[model samples]
Target: MDMNTTPVLQLTGICKRFAGIVALNNVALSVRAGEVMALIGENGAGKSTLVKTLTGIYRPDEGTIELAGQPVRFANAQDAMQAGVTAVHQETVMFDELTVAENIYVGRQPCRGASGRIDWSKIEAEAEKLFERLEVALPVRARVKDLSVAQRHFVEIARALSQDARVVILDEPTASLSQREIRELYRIIRQLRDAGTAVIFISHKFDEIYEVADRYTVLRDGQFIAEGALADITEQELVALMVGRTVKQAYPKADVTPGEVLLSVENLCHPTEFDNVSFELRRGEILGFYGLVGAGRSEVMQALFGLSTQVRGNVRLDGKPVCVTCAADAIKHGIAYVPEDRQHQGAHLTLPILQNITLPILSKVGFFLRGRRAEENKIARHFAEQLELKAAYLTQNVSELSGGNQQKVVLGKWLATNPKVIILDEPTKGIDIGSKAAVHRFIGELVSKGLSVILVSSELPEVMGLADRIVVMHQGRIEHTFNRGEATPEMIVSAASGNELAEDCA
Candidate 1:
């Protein structure tokens, strides 16, 4: 690829505002043909707004957009697609009842003749060709709902290519994918670049940015900060640019002494999810669950939290047997769960921050009685301060907050329950690095105050840095266990990938 070639897409002085908030302020970016440009920033740093503007979901309040040296203005998303710009979002939106081939050629299906009858055979053949070009094996006749998350993403890409897209934007594409799926997606991205399509890869994971992107662009607080080659920049430097300061310790794990067992699971089994998962979480301990995608880590946690009815296990709390059949039962037994899907399961996006925080404790707030607003506000304020949540007011809807702040609200709600044991499944999954550090510090504080926690994460560094003891899961079973001093990235990766379990570690 010629570095001096004209950019396939370019945006200069892009500015967008929503009422009082400035989303993108004079942001600029350019992507050359056959080159991968990484668009990176912290949450609320205007990455999403910029992407929406580029894709014509939001007309920029101010900016000049050019494609191949020609200025263009898109009226809407369809217009952008017609102009050869398309996006594949993180959460794929498709008709679940439609077949894969239909989804690939949904709005612009081929017509047979003057009668305008749909050409099903042509659509299927084109879908197959697209998959073959990307080196993906997927059946065109399969229903969209029946496909895996990775497969759905591939279908989205195929749809984009079928629309004659010259510039392809992928927003957080690997967030839900497994290690293998991520590698395959990377391969497909490289193929697109080789075919001379301008690729914009947006992600928070620095490793992925370094692995797949040829050049990098940084955005901060709705402003373009820098642009440079990936090889010329360091990870620390990139973090500094995104956060406006250096993050010395990404994992702020504190030293705490473990106490007597608080909760114990004995031969816990779920018919199709996980089997014979036994572990003991001690007071003042952060027990980490490490696994790849589909390793049953989240499933076992959900079962322990009484979210699964097919679970068969004996749970003991504080040396006494306990039965938790539902979420209410789990809360009653002093257990709280922060689910992985924060947007759906963790926090109520439509509710105010105060209401979300005080949701689980409504019973104590005198639900039947009036005039409890002060109490609710006080409790919400306390936890919000503890988590360092940034918001204009407690009355602000959670949907208005950034991803990190919303996650904090989720943690706040569970903390307000006053449980002895808390389960956090991918707590820092989508939030930025600064928020991750804050959450890690908060976890350390919780354990220091005699609380026990089950930390389930796919990131190896997170588990290795914060966990006093790490448990590796594979195929719904516990494969290995390691103390903080004994575990290494290599051992955890080996166990997570289905290598032979180490008897000694177990």
Candidate 2:
């Protein structure tokens, strides 16, 4: 093994296939000591498969993995870790029932005090020491379920650090974290790097990458397209490489003005989900609800759309009261919702795109046997073109398109209903910048067309840049509301975190 020249980990010509789909072909990456290598690609572009292969979750069909310049084959996750390779994924899984100390030291538990029982006191003390070292607030005895999502994520990171591995892989590490939490995570990562640990950061956030990554590796269509010093590449170039194409404009602004009040809610109260929620959505206005997870943003939207049972509110459409108790009622009132997790809830994977796209408006059609197919195709193609869907035809399976395109299909399905108000929940999750630009553009256009839009997004930039008026929520309560030129990212994020705003202007 070459001490000065050997990479910490070297992957050469990696190739993997899944059900006749060539997921990875001729992909290569080399990770050095004390450097953070960012692995970025579009969804289903083989980033997960590549990491799985490296961690022994999946074996590459062809390629060689060299650790310290010596070829090694990892039989399992444990084996990979033993060889100094550890991965902390997007979903951090641990025993909710286990104590923090036990969760951190799972496989190799600390010795008991000759009683053959787990040394609870020793475990707690050690856990406290680790938390202190990282400057993270965590109770060793606290139940995992009692902690917040961000806290649980930190616990997962603690477990990874406990492994004493030379290389760490983080997938979407900051997805659910607040800006403050993200800074803390970055601090810990830098601490790890300073300890000579090589970090592999995988995230869709461009700013986070530029701030932390030492090098950038871009993968597209399961193949390594570009790798360069992070400082050498511009953000635009990086985006282009990940998408493998040129992206035009984002925020496709359409010329629009308020036609009328499309939907108005007067003194809405769902005691369980929300209380005294009052708002009005005018035509061609995008009112974005900005809040941290569990701030009751989604719940309020759901209540208005008839998804919540305990909702008591006056929902009016065009100066007339409307009843909403279920999805059918919402549809009847010309309200469409593109939910979060489009794959899980919005699309039928086994069914073709046409079926999913038409499911919302299925009952409206007379089903003339002669022109049914042509009519369906025309409708699907029209919106698909508007969305710039990646698939070739309307009959293609929704499961085949990228994450961005799948989301577009979900929007298309709802758009088929000719809704007066559209509610989009985390509409751009797991999507690339190119696709994100497309979606922002589409939303701008839809709002311009006198379609009221209630957008729930975790991305601060999305909400701050696109929303006409921003409503900030904190702990199931409306903390503040900001009109145009007032709602900045700093204020929204601060308010969402339950902190007092510097300038309290509701």
The top-ranked prediction according to TM-score is 1
Model 2 has an lDDT value of: 0.82
**Model 2, residue 167: C-alpha shift (Å):** 1.7
Candidate 1 matches the true fold with a TM-score of 0.96
In model 1, which range of ten residues has the least summed lDDT? 497-506
What is the number of residue pairs that collide in model 1?
A: 0
State the lDDT at 138 in candidate 2.
Answer: 89
Residues 242-350, candidate 2: write the lDDT tens digits. Answer: 8877665555545666567778887777776667777878888888888886788888887877888867768888889999999999999899888876867789977
- Residue 161, candidate 2: alpha-carbon lDDT: 73
Itemize residue pairs with steric clashes in candidate 2: 252-441
What's the residue-level lDDT of 393 in candidate 2?
Answer: 62
User: Model 1: per-residue lDDT, tens digit, 294-361?
Assistant: 88999998888888988898999999999998999999999999999999899999999999999999
TM per candidate: 0.96, 0.83
Clashing pairs in 1: none
Return the top candidate by lDDT: 1
